[model samples]
Target: MPTQNQSLLDALNACVAACEHCATACLQEDDVKMMVGCIRLDRDCADICALTARFVARDSAHAQHLLKECAEICKACGDECEKHGAHMQHCQECAVACRRCEEACRAGLAA
Candidate 1:
């Protein structure tokens, strides 16, 4: 293992990938209308994750602030995904990925 911080970085990367994939999946669903909210949230969460990952990767001074915002976005996306989780496996996966990102963001905030 590269160590815990490295593991977190890896997880954050995974979350970003998950968010992007989920957004694409939402767009592909037969009932586009049903996934409107999910896709919107997925885009937002993915953007946040990408931005936050950049900050963390550079070990930026503003990482704390960015991570805080990332946590908030993740929470909102997670809640939205939870709503459609029963029917959409992608949404459920997104919810899990959002939670993971939230935890990683929070840890970054505390660092």
Candidate 2:
């Protein structure tokens, strides 16, 4: 596979792990209610990222469409995670991963 595609796949995998971890951590937080949105977005992002990665890995014709959608979800997740980044290490980490994944997905689509 092309380097761009490989990088995007890696980013998606990283984001999947980050979002999964972040969501679980958020549920354990003292203020779980406040983190509900973040948690929801995290789970959604993780699922999409995983599916996008698979589409890219298989060199599917739908990869580009999935990448575009993944980028949008990543950005949304990043925005939500950023709101709690300062207070939560997991959110901070997740936000960074989401941004990286978003960029990678965009780059893959452009390629």
Which candidate number would show the highest lDDT if scored against the true structure?
Answer: 2
lDDT of each structure?
Answer: 0.82, 0.95
Q: Mark the regions of model 2 whose C-alpha exceeds 4 Å error after superposition.
A: none
List model 1 lDDT by residue over 1-111, tens digit each. 236557567667777787788889888889989888878888888887788778777777887888898889889989998998899898898899889888877876776
- Please report how far candidate 2 places residue 76 from its true position, in Å: 0.5
Candidate 1, run of 10 with poorest lDDT: 1-10
List ranges where model 1 is wrong by over 4 Å: none
Give candidate 2's whole-model lDDT.
0.95
Best by TM-score: 2
Clashing pairs in 2: none
